[model samples]
Target: MVQFSFFVLPLCFLFNSRKIDNENIKTLQNDSFMRYINLESLYLEDNKLTTIHPGTFSGLGNVHWLGLMGNRLQTLDGGGICHDAPSIRWLSLGNNKISTIEPHAFDCLSQLSDLNISLNPLQSMDEDVFEGLDRIKSLYVYTIYYTDFSTAMFDNTTNLDHVYFSKFRYCNFALHVRHCEPNSDGISSLEHLLARGVLRVCVWVIAVLTCTGNTCVMIGRSLMKHENKVHSLFIKNLCASDLVMGVYLIIIGTKDVVYRGIYNRHALEWKESFGCQFTGFLAMLSSEVSVLLLTYMSVERFLCVVFPYRDRRPNVRQAAVVLIAIWLTGFFLAFSPLIGHGLGYFDSFYGNNGVCFPLHLHQPYLRGWEYSAFIFLGVNFTSLLIILSAYTGMFISIQRTRRSIASSFTTYVGQATNGWIPDIQRKNLRTTALSGSMYAWIVIFILPINSAINPILYSLTTRTF
Candidate 1:
């Protein structure tokens, strides 16, 4: 693999030739130079030649290599080349003005092994451009500069060894080679150098907010001393979930920054591997449980307000049972990938970042009927609708209850001493209602924000008006 990285530079030929004038070079049009003397290698680099005719080298049957670097040619007709040099093995056309390559241009060159066309302004390379060269082991093509290479682009090549990109200099160029295997260290080092400081700040902010917010919610619930033990229990569980999520965010963010920076100096430890798997499982579990808990909270509120005495609320014990059920369901769902697919460590050219999240919904090894894209869309949409509908009903009921209370207070104002109703338990009712309202709003607000963050990052990085 390492040896192939050095073969990007083409061999040079230094020889004396007749001093050809501009008119002669210009007059050499298409199909005019078919009978040149036997040439093993030809060098026409760093020249002003703008065209190569169909039969320019038709008779050069002995030609083994060709160089056309640093030229003004805009296109290369593969049909033109294949007609002449069927035995050509190596070809270099780097640093040219070529923007396109016609398919079947090199169809006749079955034994061709190396091809370099880097540093060109090509917008696309047709897949069919590589149709017949099964023996070709290396390919060097110009890619969208500064973008990370994705493995998907090179999936078709079964035995490809190396790829090179050309970098221009004052009067020359050099090739930068990349192997096909994932280079986890290089990816980790680059990510650490670029994202460490920002990630640290993000982790700090998340940790402080999560810890403070959850602690406040817990304290508020405890202070209320509500009679409804089920409501209090659910509130405690939600706080715990939020606390776990916050800790997860901090740990993941810190690891991403630290490991990337020290990638080359250290091998990943066993504890780190365990942490990766643990964090992934917990993050997935907590996220799912949070969603289910929100749904349950909405249903509970709907029953408390809309049905009142008609719908008997779950007791403290029953609520505890439900919470346990939710956790178990989340655990099984989140860790299913590990149980079914055999979780193992993976390192790619991008570096040792973390444990893999279950393969994105398309791996053949995954059991059961695959969830299609449409199903995911429908499931999320339905969940959102259910939560929204329940909350809307709860809000309307609260408004009506407040109106009724106001009317009653007005009617009893004259009969009450000092305008106070001693028998009415106003404080307890207000506390219960207010707590439920606050919890509902928090769930509604956080769900949308969490879902939007990933999409926002992708858009900001890849899209521009």
Candidate 2:
């Protein structure tokens, strides 16, 4: 029952314990751990110890796990440090100042399974460095400096199943092994980089254009002297949605740039931070809001065209309510994963690409989120149908109205103005047709194009790319 933690001293008192968890202890003498002969595990990580005395772990026969990560140890001397520790299995000397290792330094620990010396400044690596780790299964050796991984570097590690090295290629063997990069999703680093480079350029350009186009639309509508109140409102809402999309694109584009340049592979900072989840949620929210607003605008236009007698315009208060509802629904849908109703969990490794992506419908164990995906598809399809039907009805109504007017005018003018009236009616009809054609293009192509590009941009970001 001896509990020691965080800089506890007196080797005599800790000798009775089977585990010693005195991490962050700056001073560890050669004999400090000698008295703990029965110790099964020792955690001395995050300390200031600069070296390991020849016999520091001489008598810890039963120690199975040794965590000396985040230390200042410069060299690991070849000695009988763990000669008595026959049961040692896991050793973590990661994030240390170990620049080199003496031959057969760990030869005593023949049963070691995992050796994590990652983030160390080791000058080189060879078979002698892992002389005793014949049974090592997983080795993590990520570092800043370059190691040419000579033929003999892994000769002693016959049982090694996985080796995590840097993403940079030093040799053909490095390429064959699993390498961790900023993009940890399924895609390879080269493919990820290629796609990201292209996306970085495209997204920024699209973002700038979207922002400018949407802003101009909003400003023009606002400055108009006799703006069509109903049409103006719909345009404003559409512009607002596009603006949100533009902002989201800008953020992701900037992140891509940073990841390629300054941050490199470490740019996956979003994986462990709240930024990943928040940004992902916000992006989804913006997209959903834009889609819903588009639907509302199309239906509003439809009502105005079909029922021209009544006032189909919504006031500011009514508009506010609808916008609020749309936003609230979007928010709920976007963040449902946080409440266990969607993906059923908030996974930082959602796509394993370092980007906090929305929960994919194809992901496993999705409770309500799977159904939510179907709902999204249904709404989008229904909205598109409404837009198409509305625009079609408008075209038919305009054509009928023009023909009726032309007939009445021809009848009233007899033969004197019949030719002139027909010509005027034909010109008017042409103008209406042209206008409808442009509206159809916007609905059938432009709107869908904008929405389509966003997902395409995202899909290009394979696995966390």
Candidate 3:
């Protein structure tokens, strides 16, 4: 038994010595040192190396820390740290000449918790450079000179907590911090204060202009004793939609004010209040419904001119049905996100406002569901095509109608016994065509502009103007 024990101990020591000797031999060759050594820590400082080979740390599975400071590396090659170095927890690449980091440069260091890349000459970092680094806890980015931090820069990281941007020398540097905790109170306070002032002015402006313009249009049509009830109904629907949109604008203004106040107070319950949810739902629903209604109105105008005698003109009943459909569709689309995802309570980074925005579909990217890419692309493309097609078709149809009217009036005048018939008919046709065309143009252009501008103006006004 004694002899056996003594022999086993000697064998164990011999094995350890052999491992050390192998590592010692690997350190002679720079590449082999990374490949063969069971190194727990590596220091590659003060190297004259200007570029690192791809997969430089491909086989360093046991490496727990790596320091590549004081190197002349100008760029990190693609997949420079390719191996699954799960044990690596700390990385220091400070004092390097790295000017650019390729996307996915640090793809394999999932276990990394601390990273220091300070004192580097890095001028820029790609948006997806740190795409898969969800586990990173502390980051030190001290000397990056030229990089704009937009929403796209931190598109992937959701778990990042502490980030240090020390010694920044550039002016007007913008750093967008994404996926941080919701600062509901801070955002709510600012929004509420702004909203109170803006809502008063918006309510007054929208009420006066919309009411006056719509009332004049309605009265003018009535005074003419318009025979076509469909045209009158179309006018009414347009006015009604505009009025509803304006009311929603007021609601949105108030919501912004309330959200800011609640967020500043750090009232989580208030932030998630039913009033907030209802307001969000109503705003989204109205905005979407307005778009659909505007589209419907455009189509109605096109049909009235293109096929006037088709006996298919929409009456008040039909218009109501169409409006209801629009509302239902909008409600379903906007509220669907709420049922599947969480409430649309998101902190706005634009002005540090805490109001309910749309649910961030990109939140699940780190969890393996890449929904944001497809949704963003699909929605924008579809909307663009729809809007473009509608506008093109409307313009083409209007031009054809105008030319036909000009030719018809010219021919009618030559055969008319009364000179007044040609003049009267021409004037009437021109007025009708101009009115319809102008209305369509307003729907296409003015509505979007109004939606965009109302939010800002509503936030600044102090009284209901």
Top candidate when judged by lDDT against the true structure: 2
Task: Report the poorest 10 consecutive residues by lDDT, candidate 3.
Answer: 16-25
TM-score of each: 0.48, 0.46, 0.41
Task: For model 3, state the Cα shift of residue 345 in Å.
Answer: 13
What would the per-residue lDDT of candidate 1 be over residues 93-206, giving only the tens digit for each residue? 877778777765666777678887878786555545666665677777644242223333444444556655421110011112225212321112222422335435555565
* Model 1 residue 288 distance off true place after TM-score fit, in angstroms: 0.8
TM-score of 2: 0.46
> RMSD of candidate 1 to the true fold?
16.8
Cα-lDDT of candidate 2: 0.54
Per-residue lDDT of 1-465 in model 3, one digit per residue for the tens?
011112222222112111221111111222444333456776666655565554455556777777767766778744455454556778888887888877777776778778888787777787777777778876777555443444455556566665656321111121233212222122122124223344335444654565455455546555755465654554454445445555544554554445454333332343345554554455445445545554554455456545657986667688777767876876675565456434222222111112333322212221112222222233323443454454455456555536554333223212211221222233334323222222222222233234433323222321111
Ranking of all candidate structures by their lDDT, best first? 2, 1, 3
Candidate 2's residue-wise lDDT over 286-392, tens digit each?
Answer: 65676676567556644655676785468867887888898788778667654542243444332223334432222222223343344344554455456556556
User: After TM-score superposition, what is the CA distance of residue 443 in candidate 1 from its true location, in Å?
Assistant: 18
Prediction 3 global C-alpha lDDT: 0.46
Q: What's the lDDT for residue 364 in model 1?
A: 17
